[model samples]
Target: MAEQPKGRLVDVELDDTIGRATPDVEHERNVAIFDLIEENVFNPAGAPENGRFKLKLSLVDKRLVFDIRNEADEPLVTHILSLTPFRKVIKDYFMICDSYYEAIRSATPQQIEAIDMGRRGIHNDGSTTLMERLKGKIDVDLDTARRLFTLICVLQWRN
Candidate 1:
């Protein structure tokens, strides 16, 4: 059989300068990164399939940076995406998240479920936005995009 695609990540790091996370946000960040490292398809355009890519996420001057490198820390390709496209969705997602948290504390189960549903819908929208932004720069499945989107939001943390 042909070998499986070697387009995968070995490690991922969120730059400290991007900002700190609360305990809960930290948990989500850890889960998202762990899940991403556990399974993903990260094939950056023109990168070799030697299978030793590391990813560093950070924000500089409000721009999102995807610092791709090899196991030896050799630079691969650095994609700095503008936060412009994500501004609205991220804002909406955070607002809905607030509502979801409040609903969990006081609303009925059905109410909580409804808010959570809306939260997931906004999350999906973020994922789609990310996928579109990464188009032609890197290739990732929906699940991968979703995880990355979570990390991105975590970097911009509210809680």
Candidate 2:
């Protein structure tokens, strides 16, 4: 069946101590939240098409938690995913982001663009992995998955 408009996400937030450290990741967090809320398909498996659902994302015990709720704030279902599958891609993404950041400071524009291309490639890899892992648990489009992956990486940020 075609996805309904009510299947879209309205709100997204972080749950607890998981927070962003770097400025780049902070910007990514804000952008991800904005992009998700503005327009994104996010239908939790078997959940009704309610346009007012909210999501509280978090990490605990090395697991990624998707705390979903209805318009009334009633509990829906919490999907827990093991972080093991995301480690390598996230690490590669971080490394490329670090290179992009440094490139911004000293490298030529062409060099910066090259690093950014690699960064985007790694980001795509992470998003694809996330979509695969979320299979049978939640339904999301590519844009939605990409934004969600960015948030996941944001939660993994540390000093």
The TM-score leader among the candidates is 2
Tens digits of per-residue lDDT, candidate 2, 56-106, equal 999889899999998788999998999999999999998888889888999
> How far off is residue 2 in model 2, in Å?
5.0
lDDT of every model, 2 decimals: 0.89, 0.86
Best by lDDT: 1
Q: Residue 13 of model 2: what lDDT?
A: 88
Clashing pairs in 1: none
lDDT of 2: 0.86
**Backbone clash count, each prediction separately:** 0, 0
Candidate 1 lDDT over 1-159, as tens digits, reads 995455888899998865666787889899999999998988898888646689999888898999999889999899999999999999998899878878878999999998888999999999999999999998888899999999999988832
Tell me the spans in candidate 2 whose CA falls farther than 4 Å from its real position: 1-6
The segments of candidate 1 whose C-alpha lies over 4 angstroms from its true place after superposition are 1-6
Q: What RMSD does model 2 have?
A: 1.8
